[model samples]
Target: MTAETLSIPGLAKPASRIALGTWAIGGAMWGGADDANAARTIDKALDLGINVIDTAPVYGFGHSEEVVGRAVEGKRDKVILATKVGLNWQGGKIFRDSRPARIEQEIEDSLRRLRTEYIDLYQVHWPDVETPLEETARALENLVKAGKVRALGVSNFSPAQMDEFSKFAPLATIQPPYNLFEREIEQDVLPAAVRNKLVVLAYGPLCRGLLSGRMTADRKFEGDDLRNHDPKFQQPRFDQYLKAVEDLKGIAEKHGKSMLALAVRWVLDRGPTIALWGARKPEQISGVEEAFGWTLDEADMKAIDTILTRDIQNPVGPEFMAPPARNRVQGQ
Candidate 1:
């Protein structure tokens, strides 16, 4: 299987269009995870030609980075390490904090956890309304100047925020929640990235497993699984999404692919994007190769829209995943 590739301006090698996402490997919110399994999963991704590993400190409260560090040890040069700053957590509560001091501290911590001298793609995890964009951008700019980071990117940022962020730093990419179910970015965020010539790291390509073809009506989420809180998983909405997923099965079968492959293929065919595929176990990523080497034409695209419109009466975005701001936490 030939995976599509994208070239970032400063990176040494082209990155696979399908990036390995470590949010689930963190094992904090998505039920639980095992370190050994996480390591194996990372190794499997690398073996499959997936060089981009996207993780964050808040993921499993630093556990994810530690696992990634150990997994990529001695092979650091082969992987494109993409991690994030901003969003501080305390007592299981997370809030956005992108002050210069916070960013400065976060980079060192990230480097130590990732066990790397320099981060290939260092991104601000979210927009901090409390901190001025210039301050955060300049702080990231200094990292590039000091050789601690190679490129800068932002996640969950609006076009206006990117405009302000670019003034102080050369923005290379943007990470946003995007999938077949949630397409809020199509209105403005995607257009802005195109205008700015920024590569898009489209996360949640499977809609948090809803489109993966594994979910069933009787399946249950345990512990603090974030899916339990997702609106789409609730009644009525859940049934609507499931029906759409079932209807989408024919499209997948017509293309001789699994629903997971079809879902991710749809994302890549939408635009210039690197679809982030989240996994905690090696088997979960087994069919990743299927997502490549396929393109959905205009008719397929139109049929997908028709199925979604016919099955889903109400649609929801991934806004529920956003962490609260510092001010909101303080008020409580």
Candidate 2:
């Protein structure tokens, strides 16, 4: 199956419909990652025609970018290198900090870690209310002017916030956690993106593996595993989501596919969305081909919607994972 592509300004080639996400390989909340396996995963993804790899500084505190750097060595031109800034770590605590000075410094750090002179897409990981939007936007624009970044994007921003950022810089894309379980963006962010012609890169397509269909009731997460704190993984909610997953599994079977493939296919079926598939090992992504060459028709979409509405009665968004903005001092 040939993967679809989205053309955005500044990209030498159109981005693949499915992009390899490096969050798990970063080994922070998802547990640690093996450098060798992560490298192989990147190679496998590119070999399978996946051209975009997204990472962030807070991901393993720079470990993911480093691993991606080594993996893309001598092949940087083959992939669309995407990374982010604005979230900083201090004394083991992460906070939002998109101040202009910080942006200036972070670009250099990300560049060095990724071993690339230019980043294909540089995004603001999250909004920092403490800093003026102009400051952050101007900093990113400067990177484009300097030829350090190819395009600009913002994740988890509201329509109004995106408009504010667009006043200062050109936004080529928008990243948001979007999946069958979390459709909040449909109410606003997505419509705004569509109107503006900005590519939508949907992350967490499987709701962090909840819809992966392999999760069992007795499944346990340990040692810095983020699922430990995820609401969907908690009791009551976990049970409800798993029930929906089970039902979704039957639907996948109707299409001769697995729940994982169905979940990703649903996102792509939404049209113009580049699903960010996170993986730590090549085997985890080996099933990606199963998600292509097919799509959910209106009936399939309605059936999935009916399943979600009936089973996931207490659905929730991914707000709990957001980092707090930087605090201001009295007399700074």
Candidate 3:
């Protein structure tokens, strides 16, 4: 791979520093998706040396995985395919369920949708407090031993949760929401991943497109766009973040990179094992090369810190988007 790669303890191969994220391609929360274009984007990403492809069943409710399956038909051996479990949906309402039976059934369903004999990495999409950590870990461990999954991972799990999970199974990776704006994980999850020797696959490196620098005060998010509910997209907060983006233009120009590249590069420089970039079109990845072959210097980091501290007076995390556990669900 042209992009730098990192070796995880139990993974079959090192993954590219940039992984093609498929949430947008799922054609759900982020709005419409063109399957043909998405398949082409996947091909383009592989040709560009991005070897890791991350998706989930909840993303478009298996539509993402199906599109991914079509894209990797002949090139499965050339990439590291990662998808997740635990989250389930019915009639467009999402809920968390990590019961052993659900995990078993979902693996087969995922395998069928992915059209793959075995998944390279199978992660728990989110923690299910109703399900015992041991139950989930044991189920994941069974899959590994049975050769259905090459590695086990968990997403959005805290250090304490991971500690309990480790008692029953080995955690190969930690997939969490991490970006310049969402620095909540840096203080704990990141350090825990390092200490536990789990690879950190940081999603939302572009902060759900806010860091793209193309977002303006008048930009509109329509349909079921998830950003519509994000606090960063709300009035005063949106204006403040946009101002930060405006200021970041100079920093990006100084480094001879676009805002998108600067955002991705910053995440890579900040120590994530891999930065997952979500894309639905080939051109969206045109600036990916800028994320490589350069490192953000101390001055650059300082400027970013200053801008964030001064601009975002009321910062927030991705906690608002978390799905409800089975026990906590009011209705069905």
Worst 10 residues of 2 by lDDT: 323-332
Residues 1-332, candidate 2, lDDT per residue (tens digit)? Answer: 47778897668899999999999998989877789999999999999999999999999999999999989999988889999999987776788899999999999999999999999999999999989999999999999999999999999999999999999999998999999899999999999988998999999998898878889999999899989988989998999999999999988999999999999999998857899999888888978889989879999999998998999876899888888767732222
My TM-score estimates for the predictions, one after another, are 0.98, 0.97, 0.97
lDDT of 3 at 23: 95
Given candidate 3, what's the lDDT at residue 292?
Answer: 89
Instruction: Report clash pairs, candidate 2.
Output: none
Q: Rate the local accuracy (lDDT) of all candidates.
A: 0.93, 0.91, 0.90
Which residue pairs in model 1 clash with each other?
Answer: none
Off by over 4 Å in 3: 330-332
**Global lDDT of model 1:** 0.93
Candidate 2, residue 318: the lDDT equals: 89
Q: What is the lDDT of residue 110 in candidate 1?
A: 94
Best by TM-score: 1
lDDT of 3 by residue, 1-332 (tens): 36888886677788899999999999899888789999999999999999999999998989999999999999989989999999987678899999999999999999999999999999999999888999999999999999999988999999999999999998889999988889988889999987888888999999899999888899999999999999999998999999988888889999888999988888888774789999999988777878889889999999999999988878888877899877556363
* lDDT score, candidate 3: 0.90
